[model samples]
Target: MSDKITFTLHELVSELDAQADELLKARHGITGSQFIALATLADVEPTDITDLARCLGVTKAAVSKRVPSLVKAGWVTTTHPPGQGRRVLLELTDSARDLVERAGRDLDEQFAALVDHPDASGIDLSALNDHLNTLTAIFRQKGPRA
Candidate 1:
């Protein structure tokens, strides 16, 4: 067997995301974007779109695209406070929390099952996960290259 690793960084990311998408497909009809938005909504306090977008490391327009679907799906609600005027805030319903919990469980199982990789043996997945999480945080802070 060759000692060199064949997978590129992009391929690794793509495969990881593909696995997540497959898990989501088996249960939820919502897309990954929607899942992310839902999680953000569940975690963050009421704030304007700009702040939410910044916290999400995305543009307001990108967040906006998901709002309608979220609202229509009954996972979120938007409202303008008395003094807040046109500044709208988002809130996640109980349904969103339930979905997040279920998805979180699936993700936990999916990650735990990584140690059983077909081509990998005697791998320290916990250590790999910590490194991956750290790298992801660093890259997420940096954002995409223009």
Candidate 2:
């Protein structure tokens, strides 16, 4: 490979995301977005719909649409905060937790295989992760203009 960077950071990220999403969907029967939302909910005790939307990098409208389907599937539920008006918080149900756990195992196996590949010479994952973090911070700060 040439020393010159042929792909922009954004382009490389998009490509990786596409590949991961395709693989995850094919293997697990879950869309990338759904998996992300479910995973996020798995951590927090509960989250507001708006908060979940932000975490998922999607609009509240999109979250609204997705929540219903997740609710129908018995993977999530809405809870009202104590003494609060009917504004509801989102949370992953038991089934959602199990689903996310399975997905995590699958991702771990795939990641381990790549990291252990014999041909992965000169690959510095820690450094790459740091660089990507910087790039992501810069782009998030700049928004669409980035």
Candidate 3:
């Protein structure tokens, strides 16, 4: 490859995301973004749209847009707490929890296979993951460039 490290990294990220979306859609009938949202909800305590958006690094509008579809699909349910007029609490349904568990296992297996492939021999995946985590932290700290 040429010395365009950032370009290569961008391409890799895009391709990986595309592939993941495709796999998730085919296997679970959910988009990658939806799956991510569901996973986040599973991890965190019950929260409203704004807090969920913050956890997902997205806008409130983005999370709001997805909520209806998730509810309609039976993956999520929203409820307004007593006296909490406009604030809606979001939670994953039992089916969504099941889907998340299955998808997590499938993705984990796929990741293991990818890293264990012959072509990936000699790669220190743990160190690579640590470096990627560090890079992600730096990017989050710096925010996005103009």
Task: Specify the highest-TM-score model's number.
Answer: 3
For candidate 2, lDDT tens digit of each residue in 1-146? 33456456557557656766887789878877778789987876488888777877889888888888999988999888898776779888888898899987787567657867889877777787799789879978888962
The residue-by-residue lDDT of candidate 3 on 1-146, one tens digit each, is 44798988988778777888988999989898888999999988489999999999999999999899999999998999999889999999999999999998887678777989898998887788899999989989998899
Order of candidate numbers by TM-score, starting with the best: 3, 1, 2
TM-score, every prediction: 0.76, 0.74, 0.83
Ranked candidates (lDDT, high to low): 3, 2, 1
Q: lDDT per prediction?
A: 0.79, 0.79, 0.89
Candidate 3 clashing pairs?
none
lDDT of 1 by residue, 1-146 (tens): 33444456667667767888777877876666677777776678576677789878899998888788788989988898898767888888888889988897787788778768876777787788798899889989998999
Look at candidate 1 and tell me the lDDT of residue 48: 68
Error of 3 at 73 (Å): 1.1
Per-residue lDDT, model 3, residue 12, is 74
User: Could you tell me which residue pairs clash in candidate 1?
Assistant: none
